[model samples]
Target: MNTRQLLCALTVCSTLASTAALAGNAPLQQVQKKWAECQYSTPDGDEKEQCFQHAITRIGSYLDKEPGNPELTVWLAINKASLAGAQGGLGALSLAEEAKSLLEGVIETSPQTLDGSAYTSLGSLYYKVPGWPISFGDDDKAEEMLKKALEINPAGIDPNYFYGDFLAEEGRDKEAKVYLTRAMQASPRPDRPLADKGRKRDIEATLGKLK
Candidate 1:
């Protein structure tokens, strides 16, 4: 090939490589945005359940391509947890269990990924699910994981909010108020307006319960 033709081909290849790298995480971000929409914007009902189901399928496809990626795995877990909430029955238990397993795997392999989101999510499952013969819920484990998450991302909204909710559930109203207030005052996430709004509303409701 001529020198000029070789140079043009090299430039094309470089541009394509750059473009591919830039878009590498685009699918992950899209899944995250869709999850926020499903969790925060969709009302609790069959429609919400369907939304989560679709998200699970999409994330599953991404996982098939990226396999064992902490970010995708965590989102897959998050979607399953949300689906469990929307399902809310014996069937929900299995989804929650799956989510718990996925989050545990992420924590074991990449504890610091997504700013300790795996810890936050695992802690949430620990407290929210049933216990004993029913499921694996354990308040003490929940506290430990949530506290670890807080240590990693002290000002993060999800960790603070989940920890506050756990505290509220444990009847530590004053402590719950402290964390919930911090969560409410947290800086808004540029890409997560719906989640921020919904979480603040939740904090307000939880605070009202203390009053």
Candidate 2:
């Protein structure tokens, strides 16, 4: 995949994995389910954009009620990133910037929240977005954030999968396969069947590419 396609794929994958962190919160769980449907089940087009927009609105209402909640804030960021991937263009960069800001806030206040999901999401954004004049994509920063996420959640599916994908993107196939394998073996989240299933597919697809 080229840069733009890789960016969108990684963006969408990171969004799916991050939702697992919110499984314990009932309202957030609803949002997570809706996101899975919109991302994996819905066809890519105007319809998918509307689905994400509705999800963004729902997440916004929850954020308004629990302004101090890191989990809710992370979900808001995740949905916004997903929307940005769906609506690719000049406007997409603005949405991605907003998402980055939200995730950074969570990292500042609650880096350990949701098993360091903010770090994983932020890492994915850093590596996937363009660098310099276009956006803030930085390999060094991405590696740092992703490694920090792994330090916090060594056995988590999202961190492993994201780190693996990052490595693969950088042409480090052997190291990437190791992390992808670990991601596949991650303990299932009982409350997040859809997210788990979807993540498994992502892991498998990435693994296939390494072959």
Candidate 3:
């Protein structure tokens, strides 16, 4: 082809590529906004759950458009897991299982992408409920996941707080106290709450027991 024709072709190609990139980012940005909303939707647990679900739906769609987006997939999984925790009931188990699988896929793709958030979700899944007759709670798994989370983000309040609860529930208050104190130290503010209040209360009660 002529030089001018080749240059025109390259410009068109670049424009199309840029447009596709912008399109991919559009959904991701929307999903992230919803995720931030979910973080502070504490007073209305159900609303918080719905906000996360909205994030999942949006991010899931983004993943459909960009199937190999490991970070987005992990975020979607974590949000779904959070939704399950915010509104735990009959069907929440199924949702949690789905989140677990998605996060596992994220780990498979890139363990580094299985960040503190992903591990925290897994930890909560295991820590919050009971086994079999009760649900999907297993303190052993909780400890494992939470420890993994802390390994990734040791300064994270969620990991420290929940891991403390896990230890306390297992009657290991000595170790649990270390985590609880760290959680309080990491606490953001009254404006931006940490994890779930109920979970935080559990952590406090566990610490109280330890004291």
**What is the C-alpha lDDT profile of model 1 across 16-110, one tens digit per residue?**
98778659878877898899899888989999999999999999898888889999999999999999989997779999999999998999889
**1 or 2: which has the higher TM-score?**
1
Question: Against the unseen true structure, what C-alpha lDDT does each candidate score?
Answer: 0.92, 0.90, 0.73
Error of 3 at 157 (Å): 2.5
Candidate 3 C-alpha lDDT tens digits along 1-211: 9999999999999999978876856665556556656765445666677677777877877778789787787778778777877777777877788888887776666766635566777777787765877676777787888888899878766788878877887888888899988986774634224334544665667788875
Report clash pairs, candidate 1: none
Return the top candidate by TM-score: 1
lDDT of 1 at 54: 98
For TM-score, candidate 2 versus 3, the one ahead is 2
Deviation from native of the Cα of residue 132 in model 1, angstroms: 0.7
Off by over 4 Å in 3: 1-33, 42-46, 114-116, 133-135, 187-210
Q: Which stretch of 10 consecutive residues in model 3 shows the poorest summed lDDT?
A: 189-198
Q: What is the lDDT of candidate 2?
A: 0.90
- Write down the RMSD of candidate 1 (Cα, Å): 6.5
What TM-score would candidate 3 get against the native? 0.68
On residues 40-152, what C-alpha lDDT tens digit does candidate 2 reach at each position?
A: 88899999999999999998888788887898888888888888889887679888899999999999988998899999999998998889889888999999999999999
RMSD of 3: 9.1
